[model samples]
Target: MKISKIKEYFSDEELEIRFKSSTNKRIRDRWHLLWLVQALNYFADDASISLGYSRSWGYYWIKQYNMKGPSVIVLPKTRNPEWLEKKVTDEMKIDLLDKLQKEPPEEIGGGLWSGPKVAHFIKVFYDLTISRNKGWNLLKECDYSITSVRPKHRKSSDEDKDHFKKKRAPKYC
Candidate 1:
């Protein structure tokens, strides 16, 4: 879409001031897009390219401005505060930590507390149903990690020691 020389809803000076002062990159980028068109007279494609957004985004933002007011340009931050705490509570965390400190799953004859195992454990003990990923995250939050004991020589080489093949007598003959 063509960017015409529309009369300033907001002055270039005002947009520039807000763009400079705003901490949010979205606000700054949006302001820059408007300023590029209204003040600098840049094309939509050029403005989007300059601001690292798709050309369609530039047109979208312009449409957003036309439909609403200037406030629509500044995107809101994605806020997710209670996602983890809602699934795994603090009490459950303490209990999980205590369990990890005592014996590993193998020692307890239960195998390793993998993601699924941790999920089942939470369901049974804490009475909370959690996904495998959430269970793994809970274990990570408790500072627990999967460990195993295996004896292997560090410098062992993966090569045949002898090249000759052993000959055996045929049983049928």
Candidate 2:
């Protein structure tokens, strides 16, 4: 119903009195509050000016109430039972760094320690299942570069490696 119609149905003083006298004061408990407000609005027919809440919000609340009942509107409880607040320890990080430094590039199958590889290594070695991006972030935080040192390949007298290298060079450069 329109705001004018709602105002005609009930006065502002009545709405204020109801809002103040509401037994539930937990603002976070949106479900109960929404139900209460909507019920009041329906009964009073003055939903538009009630608490200055938007008409769309009120409509959505009513719709949600119809679809899922009052209890569903309440925020679900989120308990971090197994969540690890602290990140990987300094000692563990140092150990990983030491291992990475000591191991040859060939040991990790050549190329740099990719994000996935680091995550896998951490999971296997330290029994930590961190995301690949998070692993990369840790490496970055430790000022470690994801680069590997490779020995320059020496060509035999018969091999023409220079020809391939020159051919692949950018013409514009």
Candidate 1 segments whose C-alpha is farther than 4 A from its true place: 1-12, 23-26, 39-41, 56-75, 80-89, 98-112, 116-134, 146-173
Best by TM-score: 1
Mind giving the per-residue lDDT tens digits that candidate 1 earns over 1-173? 57544446799889788778888888888888888888888987789888999999888777777677775777443343544454676777787877776554543248667677778778777677789898788777777776777755675554532333465777994
lDDT for each of the candidates? 0.74, 0.54
1-173 per-residue lDDT for model 2 (tens digits): 63211212224554355446656643233333343454444421235236455666556554554566545344332323355543688887887777666442453454566667677777776777889998788777667774656656665343565555555556894
The TM-scores of all predictions, comma-separated, are 0.47, 0.43
**Predicted structure with the largest lDDT when compared to the true one:** 1
Worst 10 residues of 2 by lDDT: 2-11
Off by over 4 Å in 2: 1-79, 104-111, 146-173
Model 1: colliding residue pairs: none
Q: Please state the error at residue 46 of candidate 1 in Å.
A: 2.0
RMSD after CA superposition, every candidate: 10.2, 10.1
